[model samples]
Target: MRFLCILVVLFVGLKAFSQDSVSVPSIDTTQHTKDTLTIIGVGDIMMGTNFPEDKLPPNDGDFLLKDVESVLKSADVTFGNLEGTLLDSGGIPKKCNDPKVCYAFRTPARYVKNLINAGFDMMSLANNHAGDMGDEGRKSSMATLESAGIVHAGQMSQKTAIFEKEGIRYGLAAFAPNSNCVPLNDLQGAVQIVKELADTCDIVIVSFHGGAEGAQYQNVPRTNEIFHGENRGDVYKFSHTLIDAGADIIFGHGPHVTRAVEVYNNRFIAYSLGNFCTYRGISVNGVNGLAPIIKVFTDKQGNFFKAEITPTYQTYATGVRIDMQKQVIKKIQELTKKDFPESKTQIDDNGLITYLAQ
Candidate 1:
């Protein structure tokens, strides 16, 4: 097994777990003596939802991440937001305020194999659609990822995840503004989780589903963002505080568009990674299709060393494809320059990231 996953008991309809820390038993997991480690993080992923209809891809959706499998596998740890539920059938779709705007994704259970093939080690389950099938769906999703040996945390049930991969222990915590998820607005709670993880693992990473949605909300407001009457939480303050609390990396999503990238206190943060493999229900028009993979190289102490941004895009028919134009890369550069001009990190045309000269 690539991970030593914990057995978390989560009952259907149960709220978020009250505890922030989980104990890890020591093991001889370090097989490599590398000083540097690479981690790749992507945005939302709903491989193929079959809730309202049968929109599964050709060949059972196994080919969704095949094109970029090698790139994804190149990292020591690969992370993505696992949107929606993973179940063949059962569980009721949550009712939406408006039928026209309601979207609930129900991906097949066997599709976890595709993620394994693509080298996904960790997944975040604290997004809006996480409760698409209500609590039952959430439990099923957690169970599926566990069965696949993929470490996941975001719900109150499992707010933190610790696993050993490549001989290094990784701790991840996820947050969202939605109910049942680790509240993104709860900054203190989030800090406690990160602090605990940092104390236990070699690398501590945080995943958040915050900020407003669509292309217009791409910029981090640096303050609390209210979207559609819902407080999306100020991603800027939240990220910085987590970093201060000992988070090594912060990966933000939910804007459905790529946002800025920054290196704060030598820790890397991607405001929003945009949609990765969302198919059918989610729109892929214009910039929404830009699915750039964030590949960060960090030292053993979890300090940011450098990074690369591999630009890619997604299609409703297919899944993910290489973007030769590097449109997302350019978009990130433009956004980062505009959103965080003071950021020490610089992006080159070839998608390399480095610090500016002193």
Candidate 2:
């Protein structure tokens, strides 16, 4: 009887092992169609009245961005901060700190071709510089952006823009911390609007101009900034909250320097991209241009699976030429390495930081 019981137990054990050894079929995740969406974003583009001589020919005032045409065209979508109005009228009222060098920018309506030629699909008009020319200037900016077929968001109409590509829908929203610019008080409403768009679209990208200026590098979260004695923005908590409400990518500016990069819930957030093509006389503020061209891949269901980053630099002077820089790649990696821990990035010959998602 004992021999019979032992035989039965051994037989059951063998059956269990056999069942465990049987292989289960793996799901073909790669079978679904995949597409790579490359998004190139830049910092402040102060292409205004700094040049007294280049008052733009009547038909082509937007010619300032002619030099970087090839570079801009390489990307699928290009975005930047339109620092001034593009209208032909509206004279300057309040003078800048320097009179001989006081800055007020306006361009002919036709120069938008330069931006289109530079591969710009969209821009953010919610900046301090946008209203520099007053209500008329701001109105002119809106009209110019529309005329150029370039989509913009900020203190303008339709806070959220719905853009479709490759059969995928994307929502873009721009915000700031003040009414004069992108008032911080409007954040809750903006979040709600963006969240609604996220629900209906595959991805949502939010751009903001905030944080203090100068050589300061540390992220002073929760603290609001008062630029020129006027409230500018509240970046820290506002950004994280936006992520919670459903923002896939968040690009920040106004710091005039690269702040930091973090991955939250598989989404990418760049605290500050620094100066892109700000030809303002300030040298230090325009040094290492760290605008990143981010490429993202999402499933049909809008689930972001991977991304890459490319870094570029701009020389701030008469010739606002942008050059690809290698150190910028190392800087971003080193900055994000501690937070991501497994963050890995490589710089290509063209000075693009290709970050591998962990």
Candidate 3:
């Protein structure tokens, strides 16, 4: 009897211990990982003077984007479309004022530091202004951006950049798809490169300077927005291709106007960020001037978590200060609502983007 009682007590104690062990939580640390990546992107950052009167030192142009410096730097990464070349050695292009010829953008080398100060993590030099002063100017822009430690993409050889943050590797590529923008012949090559990068990196971000200029019917959908036999780009199709090839985010610009944002294949594509900050451009400032900004959040594995757009309006003609007028904010809200009905654009009393959704 004594032996049987002792055996029962031991069995009971063992069972209780087993139950307690099972109740303990799993020790996996993935849930506690503090690695959340954020990328903030803006639109055409024109850094050139239209003429002698419109000319400002490269440093002067830097002030144009200074207003959003804090907001940009707050993100893990920030990027924009560098609208012009950064070479001061070249003369203006002869094609200026050809009706088809638009503007010449050549920033002085001295102002390169301002680009860094403005919180630009990356800049795309694949726009029309890239070769404004010709290939020499393009070369100079490349060297200048590199000297400032700014990652640049959209060139023939260095078409993509790889960045490692936390434990995640990010690959960024930019293309134009026609003319100086991307050269349609290189479309397949661009896609191949992005795919390869996607295989190695945790996330892939693609940028393109495409889409038709002005508010036209064709601009609503996707069309080959070529001008004077030159191919600028087709924003809609360009984005779709990149995403299909494993891109996590697609940033589009060069239309000088904000287009629609669509979620395709579980990815977010900003068709056109419009004009983020440009001084010397009047045609771009119609309606509510230019309001554009996109925010993205991702996890350690580079999976997108959430996104939102902060609409901003630059005052027309004045060229300084964001238009904080209530009517202007409401107008952007109405425009964005056309595509993202869940999106709401609200401005605070001081004229800042207080809240945004969808």
- Per-model TM against the reference: 0.92, 0.73, 0.76
Q: Candidate 2: which stretches are off by over 4 Å?
A: 1-34, 50-68, 91-104, 180-182, 218-223, 226-232, 281-290, 296-307, 316-325, 337-358
Worst 10 residues of 2 by lDDT: 20-29
Residue pairs whose backbone atoms clash in candidate 2: 62-111, 176-182, 177-182, 177-183, 177-184, 178-182, 178-183, 178-184, 309-353, 310-353
Candidate 3 stretches greater than 4 Å from native: 1-33, 50-54, 57-59, 91-100, 178-181, 184-186, 217-219, 281-284, 315-358
lDDT of 2 by residue, 23-50 (tens): 1011111221446555667777665352
Minimum summed lDDT over a 10-residue window in model 1 is located at: 6-15
Clash number for each model: 2, 10, 3
Candidate 2's displacement at residue 87, Å, is 1.9
In angstroms, what RMSD does candidate 1 have relative to the true structure?
4.4
Candidate 3 lDDT over 1-358, as tens digits, reads: 2233235335554222131111101111122245667888888876555343456634456566566666677777788888777776655452654744476777777677666876777888777777777677777887787677676777664566654444455567788753344453366776787787687666788888876666552133556666656666556667778788888888888667776665666676777777776656435546425665667877755565666455566643343344445433454345545755543433343323322324
- Report the Cα lDDT for residue 326, model 1: 98
The model with the greatest TM-score is 1
Query: Residue 306 in model 3: shift from native, Å?
Result: 1.8
Model 3 vs truth, CA RMSD: 14.7
Q: Which ten residues in a row have the lowest lDDT in candidate 3?
A: 20-29
